[model samples]
Target: MALFKRLAERQRPVLEFTLDGEPASGLLGDTLLTAVLTSGAHLRGSDFSAEPRAGFCLMGACQDCWVRLGDGRRVRACATALEAGQHVLREPGRRP
Candidate 1:
């Protein structure tokens, strides 16, 4: 189950990745925020509210779309590019 459905630009090359240990794919040149939301079930749950967050600003300004990389580094999904074979965890500080 995906969050946001892709309505346009469906012709780009697909890039494969993992979301919380689950295999997922997204279009090339997509942002991590868009990739995960459209390919996975949902974004990371909020720490403050324990509810799902899609992202507030949709840019790099807000601190809402943070995700953990395989190396344990934190990055904003909204500003980060979707990389091929990326291991993304919804929980911050979680290593792949």
Candidate 2:
């Protein structure tokens, strides 16, 4: 079961994006972490152990939801909003 679920009967606008080269979508106003988690996707893998991590803290404190943008810039998934046509890489080593 998903931790996050849409409550409204009317669907909100969705933002289309690529997750590790696969097509994905999320509701507008959702943070990157929320989108990924709600989609049942892993946010990232730990750098040291290569174990998958979604996020520890939904806020910006845990530093567990870091992801790379299509341009290769790293950002905290929990702190970043989901944008239309955005692309994200879930693993640490993959670029864009």
lDDT of 1 by residue, 2-96 (tens): 88899999999999999999898999999999999998666787877657777789888979899999999989999999999999999633232
lDDT of 1 at 33: 94
Residue-level lDDT of model 2, residues 1-96, one tens digit each, is: 344666663277988898888888889888999888777646787877776677898899988888999999999999999999999888753332
Regions more than 4 Å wrong, model 2? 1-10, 92-96
Candidate 1 lDDT score at position 75: 92
lDDT of each: 0.87, 0.82
TM-score of 2: 0.83
Against the hidden reference, what TM-scores do the models get?
Answer: 0.89, 0.83
